[model samples]
Target: MKILLANPRGFCAGVNMAIQCLEECVRMFGDNIHVYHEIVHNKYVVERFTKLGVRFVDEVSDVPEGAILVYSAHGVSPAIRQQARDRKLQTIDATCPLVTKVHMEAIRYARQGYNIVLIGHEGHDEVVGTMGEAPESITLVDTPEDVEKLSFAPDAKLAYLTQTTLSVEEAGRLIAKLKERYPQIESPPKEDICYATTNRQHAVAQLTERADVVLVLGSQNSSNSQRLKEIAKSLGRPAYLIDGAGEIQEDWFTEDNNVLITAGASAPEVVVQEVVNYLKTTFNAELEEVVTREEHVTFPLPKELRQLQLSN
Candidate 1:
């Protein structure tokens, strides 16, 4: 057996920044810090933090009036922000800059009096926050079929934006359909999908070509992770999305199978290593690291944290 590991698979810059923000909060303010949601979607990461006494709340009211609250990388609606302020909570915004760009575009197009067609899965944290920017103007579409369901006239003043974590190919299909139906529709100045998501998907697509079976390391709810699995499965390869080593099944592979292993952007390197080690010990697999892209991206800590650091 052989193992093909993807290089740009786990912990993108945004996830790194968010995790650091939470860790810094824990160190500075102690374990009593409250996060608006799971800092990232990975189950292991949230469980680990929960053990450290960090509280992940679904509602701002769950937090104490004066407690420190950290926004997840997935961002939040303005109403959520207002609620935090109303509670007198000290807040740190850890939203990914890429996601923020989409929010900005939504605001811009809405102010310009355009009906916005947002390309993203409905109810996703990122999508919810983005639509909240201009709820009256924005309509969420998950697929080309959703585009057909749109009731806007062809000549309607329209603009489009996307959720940052969507599958590139899926988003492309929706955009093409939107254009077919509304030839005059405008697009954002930049693409909404983040670099990390595109690069990781590209890497997995490349690996799947040479791999007989693919193993994607990510939680069930991770959008980018699910996209990786879908891409592999779309190419007619057997793919599995697992959280860690224990979830791997012996029946899924044989000595002749070439396995491609990758993790989602929110997944940790330690979990990837654990999976790699398990495969090696079980199949005596020859491991090969495949690099599809080089990433040097780094996001600075939240301003509040930086200011606190300077003061200390």
Candidate 2:
């Protein structure tokens, strides 16, 4: 069996900055820190921070007053930010700059009087926060079916924005459908989809076309990881979105089959190495990186963290 790994598959700059912010906070504040959510949605990364005494909480109310509270890389609504301030919690925003850009677009569109269609999974943290930006004006759509069901007033102007980590091809198809339905709909002036997502998906596209089986490394909640599996399956290849090597099934490796290994943005590189090493040692499979894109994007530490780092 052959193992094809995708370059630029794991840990985008936003995830890097968020994790680093937590690490630095742990170093600066010692064992007393709280994060608003999973720092970047990967279990391994969350578990690592938890082990270092970074307590994770879902609501700002759950966090004690005067505690240093860090927002996840997914970003949050304006209300959450205000809530943090009301509690006097030291706020460290680890929002991916790309996600922040989308938030700005949502606010701008709402201010411009256009009913917005946010293309993303409904319950996703990013979507939930974005929808909150202009709750009354923004409607959610997760699939082509949702597109067909759209019933905005004929006189209502429309614009669309997407969750940052969505499948590029799927979003493109949905956007095409929307344009056909509403020829005058205004799209986001810029692509809200992050470069990391597009690059990783492009890499997976190259791999899935050549491999018989595709294994995407990511948490179940990881949007981009799920999309990688979708891209592979859409091409008529069997695929699995496993968190790590332990989830790999022995029956998946056919005698002469090729397997492609790729990871989500939030996934750790070590996990990919573990999976690749396991495959090679167990099945004597050879591994090669399918180079599709080179990612050099690096988001800085959260604004607060940068200040704190500068002080000491």
Cα lDDT of all candidates, in order?
0.93, 0.89
RMSD of each: 0.7, 1.2
Error of 2 at 268 (Å): 0.6
Best model per TM-score:
1
Residue 293's lDDT in candidate 2: 82
Cand. 1 Cα-lDDT: 0.93
Worst 10 residues of 2 by lDDT: 295-304
**What's the true lDDT of residue 225 in model 1?**
96
Candidate 2 residue 254 Cα shift, in angstroms, is 2.7
What TM-score against the true fold does each predicted structure earn? 0.99, 0.97
Tens digits of lDDT, candidate 1, 1-312: 999999899999999999999998989988989999889999999999999999999999999999999999999999999999999999999999888889899999999999999998888899999989999999989977789999997689999998888899999999999998999999998898999999999999888989999999999999999999999999999999999998988999998889999999999999999989998899999999999999999999989889989998
Q: What is the per-residue lDDT of model 2 for residues 1-312, given as tens digits with 9 covering 90 to 100?
A: 888888878999988888888888998999889988788888888888888888999989999999899889898998899999999998889889999999999999999999999999988999988988989999999899999999987656999999999999889989999888888899887899989999988888877888999998899988888998899999999999988899989898885789988899999998999999999888999878878887778887877788888899
